[model samples]
Target chain A: MSTTPAFKRLPRAVREQQMLDAAVRVFSRRGFHAASMDEIADDAGISKPMVYAYLGAKEEVFIACLHREGTRLMEAIAAVVDPDLPPDEQLWRGLRAFFGFVGAHRDGWAVLYRQARGEQPFAGQLAQMRTRMVEVVAGMLGRATAAEGREVPATELDVMAYALVGATESLADWLADHPEADPERTATRMMNVAWLGAAELLRGNTWHPSG
Target chain B: MSTTPAFKRLPRAVREQQMLDAAVRVFSRRGFHAASMDEIADDAGISKPMVYAYLGAKEEVFIACLHREGTRLMEAIAAVVDPDLPPDEQLWRGLRAFFGFVGAHRDGWAVLYRQARGEQPFAGQLAQMRTRMVEVVAGMLGRATAAEGREVPATELDVMAYALVGATESLADWLADHPEADPERTATRMMNVAWLGAAELLRGNTWHPSG
Candidate 1:
């Protein structure tokens, strides 16, 4: 019988990432309470103790997954946005990148938004992440309006940013159910609502900025 | 000492609703897997057998809760929208009702969106409810644009409806964090995005629609 040699061992950083990847997949599917470290270890093709050694507790593993996935999503959006582009164009690209990322990495998005946010124990941490994300989006909206040479109220911009983010998220949820739709298609749909509505706001339409 | 009845004598429909209300609260808080039937019974001020008899099984109880809550939400939206009013006015009323319902019944909203959508068996039902909601919004969009003598594509309207729904849901989640914010305020914030973006689309601004 011929014996296959074991794959070469990886460094702690690489192994930790591997564990996080597995945890994200499992947690996204089964949620926090239903997911077990043993299942995660099995998914990663690593032993149980090694998963602990690399990732600490289940909560820590979940946090690591959020960090990895959230950062990746932010970077994905950044890659698509161009500062020199027209304001509408920049917003369009960013929305497209966001839906694309969610479509391609559904598991990661689910881990960050659905699983982690649903866990009460992690609510404080999740709130911080949410605030940071909101700030990033608010910053983008501010930049876009500034490019248009319009002085949009920061509060109005903040509300718009929140609405834009929410719309993207709801569309993403819709897309998850109808998997046949392409990410670009989803992004385009979102852009129509976001950019057009945003333009109306900039034109000083009667749309009240309530919250 | 006077004693309350053992819950066995309660009418079936009344008892069922009571159990469902409890289930919604518990399920929303602890999620489906973590929420036990025993605790649900306790929350309902009843015994285990009474709960079981009133609502078939744990899953059945959850489904019952979802159906009831979803119906309540749809009704709220329906009640607020005036068909005779102009499209924009109708949309505003609907948005207000949605935000109002969610603000007052946060647990119901959580159960409908977060817990039910996250749990497996109930996910399909929630998906259907979500689709129905999008359809309603799309229908309204169709009427509004047509009344204004504009002809946006059905696909664009569908996407916009999705974004509108998303904006409402996102505001709902945000309200959980900022408890002091009123429903009217949240509704107004959503209307700013919806009406502005929607009016722009009717005017041929060509904001790229998402998938």
Candidate 2:
């Protein structure tokens, strides 16, 4: 009747993260459909009931992973991005931090954030986060535009935000593929495109088709 | 029984396309997994055996739809994009056609192109097409930069191509959402970002982290 060391009670936060880590690994491997709760529970080394007790059902578990990873990523970028700094610096820090996060948490970024885009169930959650990111970027662009005494049209500005976010996500996929690539250098390249393009637009530069 | 009129004998190409159109609609509605052979066959007014005879199985049917939609999209863009033109014109036309295809075939874009990215079975197919696109853009960048008598590092050039492609795909999603958004006009706005940013890079203008 000695106390069992392997079955020691874990705190809620630690257990939840454990479940999520296992969940991400499983989901990344098997996708959302083939991945089973039993597998996740086994992978976490916790019973199925403990998984249910900490996180809800499978969908809830997936959402928990998305929320946790997405928040960690957003916060990682947010922490370094100071609004008072020049917009280029803000963007540089943000992109660097973003690539850094994805580089470090490849599984979370791949399974939770990147893979979630294709599933309808998670689209709302993903869109909410994307909309927030877009708004932040639009605000940055607006501030920069005002500094330059020019403006981008509203609808156009929205699409620009989408383009910028999409570019980062795309590059995130690239970074995930090339583990040897430097996140800082990737961020620098992205800044070259995004900041320069955005600066041109905020300065009211436009392109036209002769047709 | 005198006759059975349920299965009409159409040309192979037309029938294949009909099956694909049905498959895209069904896949978009039900997703790649939940979508069944019975449902898709019924939707196309063909029997289950004919579906198998023509399209093989569920995975094959999904791949066929992806191939069809992806090819059509590529052709549309290629028709408008002339490599002989300036890089900006080439990119502008290419983007306009891409957005147009996505706008017209939102269902295909979502399910076949976008959704397929998450599922492992289809990732290879999707990646093949995307890699081709990245290669084309990279070649264009090389040409554009050489025109400016500057050279972007090989890895950075690869990533710049990825960033540009990702930006376009992100805006394609945006175009899919806003049905009223004009594809050509959106292309102009995108050009303003992509071309300007790219042009700046070709001219050796780059953003740096000052901190």
Candidate 3:
């Protein structure tokens, strides 16, 4: 008798990834509430039991998608930005990386930014990613200001970072909606709006309320 | 027998509003998917049939809530901002009014900004409001630039306004999460980020990527 197994079993890692890709696609199409395990399993070409075994319940599966995609986006930006570069250059790179990631994974972007932001448990995942991104952006903002021989109050810097990141994400969301928009050009447009404005602040031109 | 009717029938306008208030409360607490017509009707002190009679369906009820609150927010900002004022002052007043509206109706803010940005019918509602707000912001951005003796490309202004509005919405989201935060102070923080950055862009501090 031949001793070889009849079918080759995929590794657990490969199976998990396949499950997540299917989940993100289905969730993007069906939304979190309408998406079903059967559809995701079928999309993965696996049994529902296999999906549950690898990714736990429906909620866990959605969260797994959020974690994976969120990590990828953060890493992509982090990989490109250099501390020694000028702030505009660093921001340009970071935005290029971000829009590139979103352009590459439009479905994942929809699931993470569009879908998971409503429900409580899933919203937390998106919020945590946002918090981390805000901190990273804040650090970059602070470092750049210090290099320019200026200081933005820490409290104010925090809000500024949040606003910059928020604005970038909004443009990213816009890119996600328009399938043909060029990420590089879009990033430049964002730089004009964000960094140009920020440069003025760096140059100590701030708005004051009149009495 | 007296000609007066024993029971008062709430006019369609009043009844429709009551149903919306109930739906907003339920949707805010239970989320869009989990909220039930029965519960919404119960909360409004009306019967299920009556809710349907006034609002049409769950979907329509939700849209009605969005329409009402979105209109209210726009009106509040419109009431405060004067076109005759300089761009900075107009933006300041707009931001202040926006934060105040959000603070006063945190639940409505969640339903309008956070919860409704996902899914189809609901997302469409939010997107429409965002489009309106973007156009207004774009007009303001255009006016400010023109006042400085220059004209920005229409396409660039569109994206620029989008980013600025998105940042303000993010701060509004932050204010939604924080119950203890003061709306006026929050508005000031946002103005510092948005207006200062905008002021620089107006001064022609554009970022150029080196070839």
Candidate 4:
């Protein structure tokens, strides 16, 4: 073998990916506060200085991990959601893809998300991600309504999307906690809760308070 | 007047309440980390030492504020929710009470809850509160199903309740952000989203995957 190390030969992009993978594992295992740079570097088989040089710092590394994971999740859902299909079918596919992603990355979803949820800087990033999710859901709802030859106010669509996204997020938290839970079954459960009401709304039915 | 200060003449319960009121206002105005004991004491017209004696440290005071506010919120909802009423009506009343409370204390909801959500110790407290809310919602759902001479699995009820609570929390966040939104109208919108599907489920309808 050559004198040079194998890792040294890898491209910067590949090295960064390796660092992120290790960082995600460490963050998931030890949590945000307790996690250390040494562990991440050791896990990646890289020197601590090299890890820092490449990813800036632990905070930046965690953010990179979050961005990579979050982007993957969004892409997964988007890939399965076909606008050509009926809206309900599109929603079902999207949900399946979402739960499936969470199921596969349970540790990542639990620690990274729960830890970030309470921290200030990380929470802002999460809010931005949530806003993107809400927009996507609102767009889907708008398209669904348009297909029915009915027009709902954009604000109403936004509100409904917020409710759906919140409900799905709650269930994702539930799934993260319950390792034995089936992702597909969870998706079906969500569809039941989401679609029945949405279908009713699509038909122009609404609940009014009893005066 | 006597040499003893007016505040000293007040009973312990009254003094503690005053301290909490000031703490809530300070925490709301300055956020959890940025809030100071000096400001809270100044607002309460008490010395810093007296504020500390009454509520322990800053963290403890924040916890105290959270407990008081959370209890008041629960009480408000409990007072309006009559089990003898139909499930939908009970839900509507409960939602109205909840949104009304949030509307009235928009600052508290926006700051205290959001700040606590990202911190470790406070997040646990918030989780406990969420669990209580989920249990109450699950109980209501169970009773609703029982009244219809039908029974759903407790786990299913719990999942549905989580979704409902999550959705409501999301909307509460939305409402907090939108100062002009009407609480009662928000409650009505939630009812339309929640009850229509729940009514269908009560009538033995569920969504299944097409495959």
Q: Per-residue alpha-carbon lDDT of model 2 for A1-211, expressed as tens digits?
A: 5253655545656777888899999988777888899999999999999899778899999998889888998899889988998888888888989988988977667767656776667867888899999988878877877787776567766888889998998899998888788888888889988888887777777677766
Q: What is the alpha-carbon lDDT of model 1 when measured against the actual structure?
A: 0.76
Native-referenced DockQ of model 1: 0.44
State the lDDT of candidate 3 residue by residue for B59-102, as single tens digits: 88888888899999999999999988999889989999999999
- Candidate 4, after superposition: displacement of residue A98 in Å? 0.9
**Candidate 4 at residue A11, lDDT?**
84
**lDDT for each residue of candidate 4 in A1-211, tens digit (9 for 90 to 100):** 3465667767877988989989989999988878999999999999999998888888998889888999999999989988888888989999999999999999999889888875767878888989998998899889988988999999788788888888899999889999999999899888888889988998889999987
Local error of candidate 1 at residue B60 (angstroms): 4.3
Mind giving the per-residue lDDT tens digits that candidate 1 earns over B114-170?
A: 666544557668768878888988998898878878877887777788888878777
Instruction: Tell me how each candidate scores on DockQ against the true complex.
Output: 0.44, 0.70, 0.58, 0.71
lDDT of 2 by residue, B104-194 (tens): 8877786676678866678778888999999989998898888878877778788899999999988888887788888777788789888
Best-fitting candidate, scored by DockQ = 4
What value does DockQ give for candidate 4? 0.71
- Candidate models: Cα lDDT each: 0.76, 0.84, 0.84, 0.89
Candidate 1 global TM-score:
0.77
Candidate 4 per-residue C-alpha lDDT over B77-163 given as tens digits, one digit per residue, 9 for 90 to 100: 999998899999999999999999999999989888888875778888998999999999999999989988998999899889988
For candidate 4 chain B, the 10 contiguous residues with the lowest summed lDDT are: B1-10
